[model samples]
Target: MSERTRIPPLSPFEEQAGFTRALRAGNRIVVSGNVGVEEDGSVSPDAGKQADRCFALIREYVEQLGGRMDDVVRVRMFVTDIADADAVTAAFSRALGHVRPTGTLVAIAALYHPSWKVEIEAEAIVGDE
Candidate 1:
């Protein structure tokens, strides 16, 4: 049987719901929904800015767990407005560059915070164990 492992909990906020921020099994890492809250826990306004912040948080989690952005294989972006799709994609492209992981953009009614415009989740493969 394949053994399963869970990544260390990483949350900028003290009040978190019932969900791990990330999990690792062997060589693969799966990151949960990440928002655009700043280090001080302040969210950004613009979609592009929020997207950037989300990716930054995701990157931090990956690096903390001994993984790199290059290892990312999939990404999911959730936005409050469909009109912000281009901005979100542009921000993602800038962050991921040519890695070009498989991605999906979704429109949602709302998120945890009213100021938050975007949230991101990701999955990465480190290597075969």
Candidate 2:
């Protein structure tokens, strides 16, 4: 079995929820739902801006796990409002267009925080890369 590695989350919720933000087993890395909220607890109401922040945080985790954005093979996005799909898609494309990873968008009733508008998760493979 490959050794599993994990990264701490920016929020205390990770501990409360009993989960890590990122995990790696061998060359495969899995990133948990990344929200747009900053370390200072500020959240961007705009879906696009929120998506941007989520993607950036995911990228940081990927790199920390010995991978790159280009290594991302799958992406999942969650939004509170379906109308914000365009904004979320635009931000996702802007960040990972060249990678062209398989993606899914989901509409959820709510999130951990009331003000949060978007969240994202990703999977990456970086075998010997």
User: How many pairs of residues collide in each model?
Assistant: 0, 0
Residue 115 in candidate 1, Cα distance off native in Å: 1.2
Q: CA lDDT of 96 in candidate 1?
A: 94
lDDT of 1 by residue, 1-129 (tens): 445565655554523665778877778888988888888877667889889988988888888777899999999999999999999999999989688899999999999878888889999999633
Candidate 2: segments with Cα more than 4 A from true spot: none
Q: Model 2: per-residue lDDT, tens digit, 1-129?
A: 999999866568678988989999998999988889876879888999999999999999999888999999999999999999999999999999999999999999999888899999999999645
lDDT value for candidate 1?
0.85
| Whole-model alpha-carbon lDDT for candidate 2 | 0.92
Which residue pairs clash within candidate 1? Answer: none
What C-alpha lDDT values do all the predictions have?
Answer: 0.85, 0.92
